[model samples]
Target: MPHLIPDTGPQRVITASNFVYTISSGLYLTAGVLYFTQAVHLPAAQVGIGLGIAGFVSLVMGMAVGHLADRHGARGVYAITLVVRALATACFLLVDSFWPFVLAVCAATGAQAAGVAARSPLIRHYGGDRPQEFRAHLRAVTNIGVSLGALLAGWAVQVGTRTAYQLLVVGIAIACAASAAVLVLLPAVMPGPVVDGPRWVALRDRPYLLITALDGIMAIQFKVLTVAVPLWLVEAITAPHWLISGAMLVNTLIVIAFQVRASRTIDSPAAGAGAYRRSGLAFLVSCSLLSLTAGMPPWAAATLLMVAVVIHTIGEMWHSAAGFEVSFALAPQHATGQYLGVFGLGAGLAEALGPSLLISLCITWGRPGWYVVGALFTVTGLIAPLAVRRAEYRQRFRPTHIEALGKAPVA
Candidate 1:
């Protein structure tokens, strides 16, 4: 019988790493805020400020870390960052004061950023011609791991003791350490042919940057799910509060079931652009349906919200697949790390700014805000194809050595 998963050693290693890291992240996601406020005894505002500062610092350092991966090696840098992340997470156990907590958070955030910066380059190196599929598999496994971790975290929340929080932190640290060990066992990915250019070449690539910005805008789907929808359901709509958790469950299930299949068609720029267009349409439908839920009977609103979430989840799968395709397709082979780092800025920006933007527009402004978000998706999706085309055109004029990296396979 054929292997159910990828049979290659590197693919297995990478998938395991994703699973372990996401489990660690999941353990923290539901517990971090509580640990800070209840266990560390930090004020809510201080905790938020510390986390915000850490996120900003990580964002700023992402590109430099990517450059480091390029100069050194993606695998080596990735492994080292994982170890650093583990150490930082362990330090959280010692944080009794606000300043100590802030420092630990920053260290963990920076290490995570560096690890993420190296991930795509490592994938590109090992995944051969099918990096998107490999990435999709990793995502699927990550979802499964996170689901398990979240369940475990729920148990910790139920206990809500200092010992529980400490155990969660220790588990995360151990998971990170295990992931680093797994990463070390993978085959080394030799750097691509060096391109002669300034260290910040990605910063000057205007077309690529535009594509990254559009990708970021589409990525607000995450914020929509976690922040906007929960508030909208509880405050704006008369729907059941259970719908929020239901929606998340739907999303996770759909991603696990369909993400890899959706990614199969996204091997080229045009295909990636098409996926973006489909995602935009889905987002528009979901948002439009969601807006109508206000003032409806609870049953009707709940049904509508579920439908909208299904559509939104479909869009999410496509958007993620397209992201992998476009990022890999447009990046010069020699500068993969830098390009991925720059591309990462869109996600960082979305996470940082999406909550405020969505809340201010969708929640505060009511129906008008949802409309704005839908329009934003439509406009960005329409522009993505054009941006990819322009980037491809630019690639045509690059040095012969750069072009030799070969184009993504035509689907």
Candidate 2:
């Protein structure tokens, strides 16, 4: 279990920060939209629009902030982003109209994305010899934190009052602030010497960009459980409605139990590609299983849905482990934060677009649509190995990895 919980002070500090940060995220995840509609009393359409704007804004902020970290320093920048998120969360209390709501959400989402990219350098600096595996440990800690935070937010949801909702929002703000404060316990991570290349070198890497694009398509699977399954269960199937929570619980528990174990094997970019391919086929099978649950009776539907979720959860683990491997392995150490920021674009796009895509493909079009979505995943997975190979060829030629092999860099 040391793999699950690393024994070093630095690792523990990072884990603690991630735990608190993700707990705040969990608080917001469950009640964020509801708080605006229920407590602030904004219309649902406005809320949706505001969130959409926030999502797109976040995509650019991460890259910018990450580059900032590469030039200045990571530890302080990461702390600042968390504090910004905290302040933005506090602004939720002041939101009264569409513009105010939009302003708050955009800042909050932007900081959250920025913090993730900014933390990459810190993770690499402190994550021992293998940052990828440490990242896996953080992921497991994240699930535990999110689950606890969700459970805490459940009380507020159950209360169903404006005061209670406001309290939850305030608590989230506190959690974020506390998370930042926790980071001060860790040592500072100074920026590496600025390389004499283009400012946005990561963006210029065409092969890596290809890998990012494919990963983005594969990232849509994230919404399958959170968005698609609940909607499908309610609208299309006869399964008990409680299965929504059941499915989430199942997925969360699986990640908590096995994410570290899963990452143990994906130690390189090529291994990550293989994991992606396996996950794609698993997702296809899971999607197919979920489709079959559509016309079954309640007991049968429930059984099939449960099985689908477990299969999907397994694939999710593989997908995540693969991401950790490739994203960190391929990044230049000097530009780790900035490269990770670029890497995040794929997942950010998936977050922004995945819900709509899943709704249109899986929920709106019915069973046949599941196969289409599954095929897309499988195809993306199958193609990833090639993408990684291209990226590998590209990276080997780059001065970073080449110079590491005791050879003089090529120009």
Candidate 3:
């Protein structure tokens, strides 16, 4: 099969760096906590609390670091974040207690968040005519990298020893270090010229903030397959437990295969908003399908679950594609990093809170709750286009509009 790697050397370099970094993410996400609990013997509650704090830290750091990237050089700032993440990850060996663990986790998480913001400018610069499409390609590559890393982590988990866990952590640390070194191959991106406007323009742009909020709400769908579907399969349906893995496999494969293609048609901010609307409706239909599987027979339940997963994944792809398009296009080029950083806050909050909400509504509340979730997505979708229009109108009518972020005509 043809690949999604960038054709140019520098772009390919970025793709390589991103792939390596995301591999570490997959490894850590899969087994980092296990290392603490199984190897270090920390209590579960402390781990949860520490992770909660780290989540908040990450959100705050993303914007601050992103602003720094806008003022300073993105490549340098990005490398620093990567180095910090590597160091913090390696420091897991020193975490013997609650507070120490919190420090390490927060540092690593914050660096990860900051790194995302810092890298935005680099992506926008090298992404050719359609940076959004390149983002989709990277997303596809990320799926592959993460899946491979997860498999490696799975092997470590299966070994189930303190030394094995230690090795896994060290491996991810090394991976992060390697990724930072790899980043040096790219050409340096100088700081953008600061223009006359609000220093924290992204924060002051009400339309952008509104879009970010809506995106945050829609981001809860990311949890559906991971948290809600597995639980629903166990509690309400008679489908084999193995189907859990099957569902995840299907999602990963679909994303790797189709994420780029899905983003191809979403060429502008307005199109991105329309994509959001379509994605929301797709989520709604998937939720409806999920509700129907509750009382079905085993084979039927399994089939329905797979079907729903396909629909849900389609929605997920669209939502992500829309995010890439709108977030990048609506943002002023001079402050791309800052805008992306601000945009990330919504998803960050969702990551911290989505699981509990899904547990309470989609899982605990049963089938009826599914409808409520669907309706929420639908309503959000219906309103997004309106927001995009308002943002466009305001920008157009302004006496001094930003050329870098000016919206194109929407059909």
Candidate 4:
């Protein structure tokens, strides 16, 4: 079958942007695996707290860094964030104790978050009127990088924990530095409008706030499953580590295969809303299946978990791609960076709250606890359809067609 990827246009900027995003994905993937394994070793009570601290810091500071990117230029901000990230990734190698690991993760998280906030809006600079497709392609490239890094790290773990940790740190540092170099090579792309006073007021826009709120709620399923499900597989069901790893590998691979296709298919406002709504429904079903894990035999529970993970992963691809497209369309030509920064805040809060809430529920209510979490997702998904119907949403949103891009207002 033939493929239907979007045109990336003639700018070297798009190519450079993709390369930069690739480095971020690769670095984060390697570092994150190590972080997760190490975090899991700590006392269960402390895990949620540690993740919360890192998330909250990233949420607040990411916006500030992004604000800088909006005022200056994304390329300039990218240059700074990459160097900081490289240094922070290297620090992970030196973290021996729990407290140090916690602190290191926080710094590393902030750097990654800042890089993302800067890069997202930067796409608008390169993409002209086709930011949605451009951003989708960037995300697809990032996913490819993530798969490579995860595979490398997965093998590294088998060799020895310390060896894997050292290799990841060194490799990620190299990637980060290279990304900075790529940013250096790109031409300056200017922000459309220069705000006279404090630009934080840009966040007060009602429509933008509503979309982010919806996004935050959608984040719960992914965060909760990745963190809480693995522990459940091991402690509650006593499944093998290999099974957990396999499930994740499957999830990543499936996403890589279908994500871009799904993105292309659902590039319309109604389609995007439908995907979110369906994803919520899927989450409800997955959680219901997961709840059954408490009642099933070990082998059966592992199988059920795998099934749930697959369904959840598909929904994830739809939700992520659609959300990216919608957010890009909604951003004003002049305030792209500021808008993306605020969007990042919604994601940050979700990352902070989702896992912590799931972990607490799991600790308190045991296996079936996630069902309650699932219900919350179901309720929140309801907002997406409403968002699609609103006139403000339609103003920035459109059907999946070349005509839509041409209609995008250029500064």
What TM-score do all the candidates reach, one by one?
A: 0.96, 0.97, 0.96, 0.82
Question: Model 2 over residues 182-212: C-alpha lDDT tens digits?
Answer: 9889878766775676899999988888888
Off by over 4 Å in 3: 397-411
The sequence of per-residue lDDT tens digits that candidate 1 reaches over residues 298-371 is 99999999999999999999999999988887887667778888898898888888988999999999998898
Q: What's model 4's TM-score?
A: 0.82
lDDT of 3 at 24: 95
Model 1, residue 388: what's the lDDT? 87
Backbone clashes in candidate 3 total 0
Tens digit of lDDT per residue, candidate 4, span 1-411?
Answer: 013244444345445445544655664555564454553355655655676788788887766887777667777786788888788878877766668768877887888888777876667766655566666666666666766666666665666566666776677777877877766556665654554444674476666678888987887777755677787777776556677778778886777677767777776667777888888888888877777787577788778889988888877887787687667766655556666777888888877777668878764688567778777777777787787557255454433331233321223
lDDT of each: 0.85, 0.90, 0.90, 0.69
**Candidate 2 lDDT:** 0.90
Prediction 4 global C-alpha lDDT: 0.69
Candidate 3: tens digits of C-alpha lDDT, residues 1-411: 276867888789988998998899889989998999999999998999999999999998988999898788888899999999999999998899999999999999999999999999888888888988999999999988899899999988999999999999998999999999998788888787667867988898899899999999999999989889999999999999999999999999999999999999999989999999999999999999999999899999999999999999999999999999999988777788999999999999999998999889988899999999999999998899998887777667644545654222111
Which candidate order results from sorting by TM-score in descending order? 2, 3, 1, 4
